[model samples]
Target: MKTLIVEDSATLCAIYSQYLDGSGLEVTSVETLADAKAALVDWHPHLVLLDIELPDGNGLDLLNETVNLSSPPAVVVMTGHGEAHAEQAIQLGAADFLTKPFDASRLRVTLLNAAEKLTLSQQVETLAVKREYLGPLMGSSSAMQSVYETVESLAGTLATAFIMGESGTGKELAARAIHQLSARAPGPFIVVDCASLATDQLERALFGTDGEVAQGLVAQAAEGTLFLDEVCSLGFASQATLLRLIQHGTYRPVGSAAEATADVRIIASTNRDPLFEMREGRLREDLYYRLHVVPLRMPAMRERSDDILMLAKDFLDRIAHEEEKDAHNLSDPGAQALRGYSWPGNVRQLENTMRQLLLTSTSTEIDESAIHQVISVNEISVGNAMRSRPSQLAESAMEPSTIQPLWMTEKKTIEEAIAACDGSINRAAQYLEVAPSTIYRKLQSWKAQNLNV
Candidate 1:
């Protein structure tokens, strides 16, 4: 480790320097506060041995300045014998005190312990910052509180987690919370999309190649977390590979004989039921068992009726802040419309709608007209509307489309698929297991019906 010795006495500075150097620590000695500050900013030492009195200024003043440091090195104050000086050093967050003429062994032990504590404290602060940045999952409902509790409980453990939720319900966010809370918080948190990559590409990404040696998400998340989204879509071969990794914590690169051990915790997320997938032969039962250690289910927006308005306002504020525009206050009618709407697209869809409204609305206050425009343009059904908690909704009838019924069955099916995919058109089509062309054809046909203004 590196050490800095700051003392006004030139003899003591030199003596401590020689002792620290002999102990295999790189040491820099400075006699004045100015030189000490310069060395601290430039050298970034692991520990400091600071004298209480300085020729230019009291070392306590220097200690006060060091606390502003982004990553402050530990300070061990050296005082001449006054109780006042020792008390001041302790108040200023000095790691420990060394009386003048202290033994070399005592100084070394104190420095070593302080350095270790400093490292641990820094790690804890980093994790706290990460959790704060991620924000709470944004719900006031009991179900959401329960979900939050589960996430908090799992965050410190190494157990594999399986998250089951509709699309746009924040599965990845929950996985991140778990990783940040876990013992491996310092390591990387890697994400893998099982549905996005082709089977061959997926295998290559997960298992890696011989010549190039790609660090598969699992390998990259060594001593951390690997989050698998849309895991139910993984092909049998990939599923088997994943199962092996979960079971044995060992995997070989695509063509290598040497097996590497993975210390990663697996967090798999899927909109589909893993049990259903397994029963249908789409997912292996053994793999399902391996991944389903702790199951966390996120409630749908409809289920958390009380939190609808809060979520809406939160989204509106976020959008307005991002755009650098005045946030629009929702009038009672507008608030009612939001609460009444089924929100088939869930939180993500609500966020996007708020952004669109903020962009389109000319007035500072969002009124019923603006809400109706969003609903009409988006073609949300009235039957699915006005169903949330009374605290959220303003009771009023939305005009039904006067247009003749046109493939109502197909529209219902599309809506179902969209909801199943968490509002992803592509994934919705995939769930229908139909060609993209077919979805496009049906959408075009529905638009041609020219539903009322």
Candidate 2:
């Protein structure tokens, strides 16, 4: 944990420093907003103990600046008895406030609790950034067989790969196959969705911010693959930073002055044509060539129509077992209907159709009626997309949806735990092996909806 104290009184800074001494946290003190901002450039602290009044300006102005950061540090404001700005400080995202003259113990406790929340939030975000590569590639088409052969050949090489494919073409599965067959299989296989991030959050998501050096995908994939999905959606700055990591194997974190070496291999994927991306100013020319080594293009399902029945049968078998249905194989008309329809969504669409068929059927074989109910057999049947909610499908496929909002389940479970622990929030958190602050935060959020413990 690290803290930066912003105060004009040198004597108070000394007192705070002594109180934090030998507490296993690094502390830095600044007397003005300018010095505090300068320290933030290189010294990214996890928490800030800010004073309401600084020699140069008011600290709330500084709070406004920091609050707009992508990964802002926690702020704890200090105000005098009559000059307390508690409500304003809270509105500006001050984690906690202290009315002067607060004892050193109170300051230490408040900062420590805020530090715990900050650290836990970072950990959750880091865990959410990773993707688990669990299975082998699932096609046996001639085109797919060729892709697998190429993957086998490049499995041991350390060179970067650029995976090219349209959406739903299993580009990510191909990336996983390469990783699992390579020497770095034992390490992590991390994914960063370039298009999903806002420009302000992209740098920190990839390279981390000033204080969170190890929170980026690159660091998390230390000896493994950092798969950049839709790589061209990345901003110019992120692309340049990625190019630096590839060219020099070093990158500077978002606000850090120093550069660190990266050992992760880059595997970038994009649905757009690489040439078109570079020509339109979305992808840089220099970076494209560096990532263009060992290109692997995934074949769209439309190009391999012969594999449609095989893929559908495989999906049916899995879905049958999962749903405990009697469906075992497709009838002749069922197979013809599947092969004739143009799959605009590719293999993913076929798999989803199979699952729906399996859910709707109770017979040993899938009939033509069940197939036509979900998939349109006529050429002009447009706008009736197949990816409907599972529970909201045709009457035959009335199985309960297995997917539900995770937070609802979590809220129910936590509320039950609190009741089981005799309404002791701390005891409930301890039973769940989580920090008490997590429950408190969730409860506070739920209170807005008139939820009671």
State the RMSD for candidate 1.
17.0
Q: Please identify model 1 stretches exceeding 4 Å from their true place.
A: 1-136, 380-453
Task: Give the TM-scores of the predictions, in the order they appear.
Answer: 0.54, 0.53
Q: How close to the true structure is residue 47 of candidate 2, measured as C-alpha lDDT?
A: 90
Model 2 is weakest, by summed lDDT over 10 consecutive residues, at 378-387
**Model 1 over residues 75-168: C-alpha lDDT tens digits?**
9999996778988898988988888777778877888788789889989886444221233477767777788778887886788899998888
lDDT of 2 by residue, 191-299 (tens): 9898898766777887887789899878899999988899877776667667888999887888899888898878889988987766444577788899898888889
lDDT of 2: 0.81
